[model samples]
Target: MSTSLGRGLACSALAIAAASTAPAEVPRVATDIAPVHGLAARVMDGLGTPDLVVTPGASPHEYAMRPSEARALQEADAVFWIGAELEPWLEESIGALATDARVVELLDVEGITTLEFREGATFEGHDHEHGDDAGHDHDHDAGDHPGHEDEAEGDHAHAEDDHADGDHGSDHAEGAAHVESQGDGAHADHAVDEDHDHAGHSHEGIDPHAWLDPGNAGIWLDVIAEELSALDPENAQTYRDNAAAGREEIAAAVADVEETLSAAGGVGFVVFHDAYHYFENRFGISAAGAISLSDASDPSPARIEEVQETIRDLGVACIYSEPQFSQSLVATVSDGTEARAAVIDPLGFELETGPGFYPALIRSIGESIAGCASS
Candidate 1:
């Protein structure tokens, strides 16, 4: 409902117009992440150029703004960040910037359904292990808390219990068979517990990687168009026009991706990280599991074992890594699972030019998934 554009934003647009016609003070726009940068690039077509400071191949997990990036943010006519929670690193820098700069938090904008982190999910298992056991208390005394346990039991009955099935089968299996099956499921459960431990901690719960979903790209485009129109009323039509065109192209790319992925046979694959949930959600492609949760943290032996078990259990069709991350981790995970390692650029780690880059990026992921499937 906060419809007012930030202060000096329209003035900056005037400056851009004036700069083109007379002077040369085009409004500088800074985007926090790659998807925003891509959408903004489309909105900025034929208008003034916007400065995208975060280069391709950089992960938002730990993007420290460099001197050059800081300078770009400080000098921008409009500043765009996903949200405070998603990009904590950018917060202090954004707060330090001049008030006159139009600080637009895109997630806060109307009509955007921000992805909520899976309610009780955490990045701790993927990032690092911690002893903060206060948040995720998974224990309850069956005697003292009979009522709560009964409720939990009811809930378990309503929702299919995967563990219960495994446990039931384990009861009848012989020694080695029981041990092997139980061990595999136990390893998977431990990994799940590790992930669950950081439930309440606020560090971007739902995957902030919405750009991976091409349908979500349409949502971002609408926001960009509205923001650009507000900033430059005179040339608003151009911004809207470009955004519409961009969306159509992205939709086509999305269609191609779906077709390719559908034909790829199984949705099973492995990724360097769990950042591709939106992609999976969009195309129904199931990454067997992530090699590691964070690019910042190397996978522990136990964690690697869980990933390997998932690959084996799911009959993973391929293993894909990102150009943004080092190939070593992917190679190791692939080697352990005997899955082929292929590089997929989610953040456009490589330079992509022209207006069609958005579609090209989407199609590239589809191609990568399909190619790895056939191989």
Candidate 2:
């Protein structure tokens, strides 16, 4: 070959080798809630931290996007949210704002176990058919209460129905195919149903509090790792390794919380709103009832009367308020009653925002409940 031809071949070979070893492009990711962002942060540990759309102290139920947040979404290569059921406002905006981004609704991701909103109910036992199937035997017998077994069974069945209606199979392809076969309106209508009403609050369908269950969080770690790895193929193993480590940590934290709350297992408590069902159920703690359905609204007089009656009738031990809402309602309900009042931060608003936030959030919940119930 001539000198010029040999030089051209050498340059081409160098280009090919460089292209072969180049690292995958890291996608800019945006996440909806703090806890969800916490999980994504773990998966993206060495890659990059995902931007959080909703800030601390803001309720996802009624968050309006700021201009900067909108810009973040527009710039994101991938957007991870729970689903329309959790943030209905995002239903239209995500498609319009983050049109170029790959939208992964963690709640719709296959292998994520979900729970339905318990209508007019408080935290019960961990008997619901979601999350890890490790059977927990509770000494707090609901059988002694009249009609408790029937009511509990009915609630469990409702939760199962909600899960089935969503058609969340273990196989991602099958689940996506099933969703597609249902037609476009199917998903929207299903979300409408799930977001429509809760406790006494007007909102969308099933309880979107799946993250409160550490088992669900463990599953989320895998899903997040898979999605991040797909986006950045060069860091696939790193993502998986982080997920494995994170999952082990979550499992350990969950076990520790369970053990700590075991002493308060049978103690009945009430909350400011109906958000902790997942946490309470996960640890086998039973709440008497909630003061209101949504933190954004005040309890109706009749509802207040009903909760007061529940507290009086059930002899509830504690009434817990959340950091995001007013404590006056909790005090009102607990006034003249023997119940002690305490606060629980379900969203980790008071904790530092990051990977540690999620585990701390769970630990805080367990400790608060145990403290109030044991007192």
User: Pick by lDDT: which candidate is best?
Assistant: 2
lDDT of 2 by residue, 90-161 (tens): 666676667778777766644445666666634444356554232222222322211112111101000000
- Predictions in order: lDDT: 0.56, 0.65
Alpha carbon deviation, residue 54, candidate 1 (Å):
1.4
Worst 10 residues of 2 by lDDT: 154-163
Worst 10 residues of 1 by lDDT: 153-162
Q: Please identify model 2 stretches exceeding 4 Å from their true place.
A: 1-22, 121-127, 131-204
TM-score of 1: 0.69
Scored by Cα lDDT, where does model 2 land? 0.65
Per-candidate TM-score against the hidden true structure: 0.69, 0.75
For model 1, residues 1-375, the per-residue Cα lDDT tens digits are 233665467778998988888633335677776556767777667666555545556555445444445556656667766665555556666666524576766544433333434321112223321112212222323332111111110000000001111112322223211122222221111122334322122424445665666655665565556666666667777867776777777767777777887787775677776667666656655555677654445566777777777776666767788775568766666665657778777666563643555677777778888898888
